[model samples]
Structure formats: C-alpha cells, structure tokens
Target: MHIKYTISVIFIVTLVIIEKENNIISKVSDKLSTQLTPILFGPSLSAPHNASADQHEDRLLENSTWSTQQSSSPASASGGQKHILLLATTRTGSSFVGEFFNQHGSNMFYLFEPLWHVERMLSVESGGTNASVAGPAYRDVLHQLFLCEFSLLESFIEPAPQDHVTASLFRRESSQSLCEDPVCTPFVRKGFERYHCRVRRCGPLNLTLAAQSCKQKEHHAIKSVRVRQLETLRPLAEDPRLDMKFIQLVRDPRAVLASRMVAFSSKYKIWKRWAVGEDLPVDEDEVRKLKGNCDNIRMSAEIGLKQPPWLRGRYMLVRYEDIARFPMHKATEMYSFIGIPFSATVEEWIQHNTQASKEVSGVYSTQKNSSEQVEKWRFNIPFKLVQLVQQVCGPTMTLFGYKFAENKDMLMNKSVSLIEERTFL
Candidate 1:
C-alpha cells in the first residue's frame, strides 16, 4: 500500500510540473505576440489587450532597451554622411530622383519652388522706395515666412520606437517559434507616434527636426526644383556650414521642349481663364527657340569646372536618359560618388516607387495637335536655326560631349532666317 501511494504521488507531481511549464510558455508567447504584432503588420496593431499586467510591463521594458540601442548606434541613427542637392529644370526628373532617395530610407525634403521666394525678395530689394506700395510689406512678410520655414527644417529627423522593432527584426529572424517581448512594444509604438506627429506638422521646421534626428546616424538629402537657376544656388553654396553637393540633371532638348510645352500650356490656360483675360496661344516657334537655348546647361557645366578640383568631383552631371534606362546602376553610382554607402533597401525602394508613368514618356504632342507641336521645330526650323545654335553654343555642347552632326546640309538648312525677330534674342 505505501509503494502504491508513492507511485501515485510521483505521477501527480510530474503532471503538475509539466502543467506549470506549459502555462509559463503560454504566458511568454502571449506577451511576445503582443509586442511583435505591431512590427509585423506595420501600423495595423488594433487588437484588444489580453496579456497579463506583468507581460505588459515586460514589453515596455524591452521597448525602452531597444530604443536606447537605436539612439546609440551610429548606423541606426544616421543613414549616411553626405548632403545631396539636386538641381534641375522643371519636368527634368528631379522629383523622380528625390523619390528614389526617399525610398533608400534617406530623408528627402522637397521645396517645389524655393526660387519664387528669392525672386520676390529681389524685386522688393531692387525696386526700393520706387517699388509698389505693397512691396515693402510683402518683403517683410516673405522674410518672416522664409525664416520660419528654414528654422522648422533645420532639425527634422528623430529616433523613433518602431525603429527599434525594425532594428530587432533586422538583427534576427527564426522559425523555432519565438514570441514578441513586452519590453520592445512601447518603444516601437512611441517612435511610430512621433513620426506620425512630425509628418503632420508639415513645413520646413518639422522637416528639420526629422532630418536632424536622422542625421544623428545618417546624412541629409534635399531636392528643391526651384534651385534650377545658377544664381539661386550661388548664395547657398557659399554658406560655410552647409556642405552642399550639386547634381545637375539635364535631358535632351527635344524631350525637354515637349515637357515644357505641356507645362506651359497648362499654366497659360490657368492664367488666361482665371487670372487674366484670354490671350493668344503660345507661339510654337518662340517656345522652340527658348528651349534650344542651352544657357542653363552651360552655366551648370561652368560651375562644375570652376569649383576647386576637390569640389569639382562633388558635382555630377546626370542625364535624364541614363537615369531612365539604368536607374539602379546610376543610383548606386550616385550614392557612391557622394560617399554614402549604397543600401540594397534603397535600390528596392526605387524600383518599387518609380514604375514608369505617362508623364515620363516625354511626349506632350498627342493630346494637343501633333502637327502643331513645339517639338517638331526640328522639321519646321530652317537650316539657319541650327547654324545659329551651333555658332553660339557649339563649343559648350562639344565640351559636354554633344556631337554636332557633320552633315552641314542637315543642320545649316534648318537655321532660323529671322533669328533676330525671335523673342529669345
């Protein structure tokens, strides 16, 4: 009877121990699930809390530790060590390039037309007292606006909680059934919340915060379409603290003319219908003349050559054709040239983001009268037009590797006979 009782006791004890271990594992798994769900779904964590209080507390602690790690680690903090500034004319793929950078986890702050503000200031400063009655007041208002915008953008990036989750996931992934830890949850949630809040607070100031925070580990990337003009960038480049590198992007004149026509036609229609009385359509000949002027490209090249040899290497000339045909390779080369480590994530991001669109086709004549399109100037223009361009811009074009067609008959016959009559003159 005593042996029977001992055997029964031993069986019961074994059963109880096994049950206890199972419960402990179940609790750990539940806690882990709570912590990791947010990361897996990415902004989709909406489940009701079912974990024990202890588990919740543990998750918060894990999160705090992860946050600390992200903040301390240079790689997690700053993405890279270069500030990239993209300079290009309208419809020249500046935005596309900026989007590419943004995908690479680079914080790309965009200024659609920063030059408009500069022009407004210049008009007021130059006109002085003779300026319009509203000029001085407008200038003061613009000054305040510019100051606020610049201040806001100065410190844009920050360390976030979700960054921890991403970092943790990046650190390890396994199939042996691991549960989320409570300690990691709070930090991820907090980081995500902060990021959302910053994005909502748009403008230069908010951008600055995000940028500065990210800069703690990575470099800064800026894309402002308005900085296309050389005069606009000169002052910025002169700033001692702003170590700006320029990437001047250009496209073939034929393509640019087509894009420009679309842009101008839209703008002209808007102005005619809303801001001003009806006006005649833009002269296709005049548009062609203006587009053919390679002044901006020449200026960019001059700037590149004029820089100290050290800085010359910093300026890269990106042709739009090269970007469209070989985005990944070009992007990698660009990042390398700028001394930033190329992230495979960034390459993936660009591929996912820049699926070719209709606008990228560089075709503006289809919707309009194809026969009357501005790009057809190559056919309509007399030989004199090509001769004029060659005479004035041939040397610069040659320096930039643009080969002039040897067939003088092909170019000379299309030259503008009434070149002096063109408005661009």
Candidate 2:
C-alpha cells in the first residue's frame, strides 16, 4: 500500500512538471508528443564513479522520481543566477554532452568556449598558443561570465576565422546569447569579419559596449576545453555569492589519445607551450597530449574530492562510454543534475540526431551515432599506441574506474614497439 501511494504521488508530480515544460516545447516543435511515456519518470540520480565498484556514493538516487521541487541550486534558492560548467579536455565528448543541454534546456543561454577567448589573449601576450591559463585569471573571467558579463572577452574575441576544427567553440548563437550587451549581439551577428553577414548596414563596432553586454540568465552554461585543473576553478566553485555546478566528462584515455593523434600533429601544441618563435616538432605529439590529458583529469578529480564541504553536490562526473552505451538513461541523469526536466522533446531530439552512420563526423556536430563513438578507438588505433597510453595513463585510468582488456599484449604487434615500453603490473 505504501509503495503504491508513493508511486501515485510521483506520477502526479511528473504530470504537473510535464504540463509546464510542454507549454514551452509545444511552441517550438510540432513533432514532440504532448505527453511523454512513463519511461521518463525514473527517480532522480547523480554521478556514479563506479556503481559496481562502489567508488562514490550515489548522491541522488538509484532510480528517478522527477519533481521540480527537488531540483536545488544555491543561486535559485537565493535569487541569483545559476551557472553550470562543462569541464573536460578535448576529445572527451564534452561537445556532444554540451549539445545535449544546449538542445534540451530551452530557457538556457549557452556560451560555447569563453575560455578560448581568454586563451587567445594569453597567446598574443606570450606570442603562442601553448600556455596554460593562470587559475586566478581564469576564475575572474568565469565569475563575470556566470553573471552574463561579456565585456572582457571583447578585447581579443572575434568571430571564428574559418571553418576550422575549433570553430564550433566560437559559434555565434552562444556568443550573442550569453551577452546582454546590445553591441555584442550585433557584432557577433554581423560586424565580425569572418561572418560578415550585413557589413554595409553596420557602423563601427562599439567593443566597450560589447565587453559589458553579458545579460544575467536564468540558466547559463559554458563548455570549454581550456581549463586544465579543477583547482583553477576553485574560487568560483567556493564563491558564496554564486551558485555553480559542474559536469565533468571523462573518456577512455586510449580513445582520447587516439582522437588527439587524428586531430593534431606534434607541431600541434594548441598553444600550451609555444613560447615566442620556438620551432615545435612536426611529429605525432602523442606524448604531450597523453600527459596533459591524464594529468589534468587525475589531478582535477583528486582536487575535487578534497574540496570543501560547500562544494558537495556541485559536480556530476559521467563517463562518455556510459552515456554512449545507455543514452537515454545517462542523459536523463545528466539533465537531472542540471535541473532540466527530461521530456519527449529531449528524447526525440536524441533519437533523431544519434542515428548510426558510417560517415566519420567532427566533434562539433550534435548529430552523432554516439554508441559507435564509444568503441571507435578499438579499431582505428594500433595496439602499440594503445599499450603506450594505457601504460602512461594506467594509474589515472584506474582512479576513474576504467578497466583494461584481458589481452593487453595484443595492443602491440612485433613490428610496432613503443618509444619506451614499460612492463604492466
């Protein structure tokens, strides 16, 4: 009798929430159903480091029971802005996961990569792209960004120059939306050089107005590949004035390294250490990518675990494999963490976009057959490189609960040996 009553209460709460979201979703799409099936009504959930291994305690629930009353944000509770950060390195599927929120949260104002603007400024001053951002500097920028202030970015920010790999990071929609500045809105939409849409009609760009134009938003999110440590973000994470949450995306290091190798060559430090005019190697810089990838996540998680009590319930760490393998279930948990309701519109969007295909896609596109993405590294990469990443990133991987295959030696054939072969324990 008690279980029945509890289920009935949950069902009633879900209906009320659906009724609210439908009002918004209905206006946008004719295709989404007015009523979602009962499947979206699972109990609320939080990040699971490793359910089988019991690495971290379940912060929300094993099952979901959706209710708007349950979604908590210090910002919302105190009448301030709510900020969500997508924290991950490149090739970790942060883009795809970010798009999940971008598409689902209709009220959300998205900022794709505010840090890239900072990175650009740093690159100019230092004469290269291979430099790490100072934590304090990064945090100061983020604090203003969370509050919807875009003025600082105007100094070095411009429309993406061309259709390059990181172009999606500077997409105009996010740039325009995150700022409340009247100048920013028009500059990104028209005045920018690369996307010269209505150049003849626009006057001289008032960049100062652009700098100050970030509008405070109800739901503000920014996804970036620039932040290298959780500690760098410690200030905002601990700020009493701001309500912030994090979605930390993790992928198998083998897959990360493989993707990086495909994307960049050794002369390819995306400006991490490219001081002045120094000549960088023109080889596959797997070693540099591997170390940075492993160290950042390992160190970030370690620092996050040791964060102050106030930071609890601020982070949801999800593996790319988990989401790819179980899209509906994982995306539901992700949305739950972000305080967004999972409606049929969101479900339908995922279904429509993720249809499997043979065509290789870039990270920027929201349309991906994500399940296939999880295992592509297995076939695309050679065993020698796999063995190398596994060796170098082994301990870090273990901390994140990523297991190895049974046939470890198969990663290397007789023909291809690692630069330094270390025996696996």
TM-score top scorer = 2
Candidate 1: segments with Cα more than 4 A from true spot:
1-80, 106-149, 152-217, 228-240, 266-293, 306-310, 353-396, 403-425
| Residue 101 in model 1: lDDT | 58
Model 1 gets an lDDT of: 0.44
Off by over 4 Å in 2: 1-73, 76-80, 128-133, 158-169, 173-192, 195-216, 265-289, 406-425
- Cα-based TM-score, every candidate: 0.46, 0.64
Residue 243, model 2: lDDT of 69
Measured by TM-score, how close is model 1 to the native structure? 0.46
Per-residue accuracy of model 2 over 92-142 as CA lDDT, tens digit each = 888777776666443566767767676765555445444333344456567
| Strongest candidate by lDDT | 2
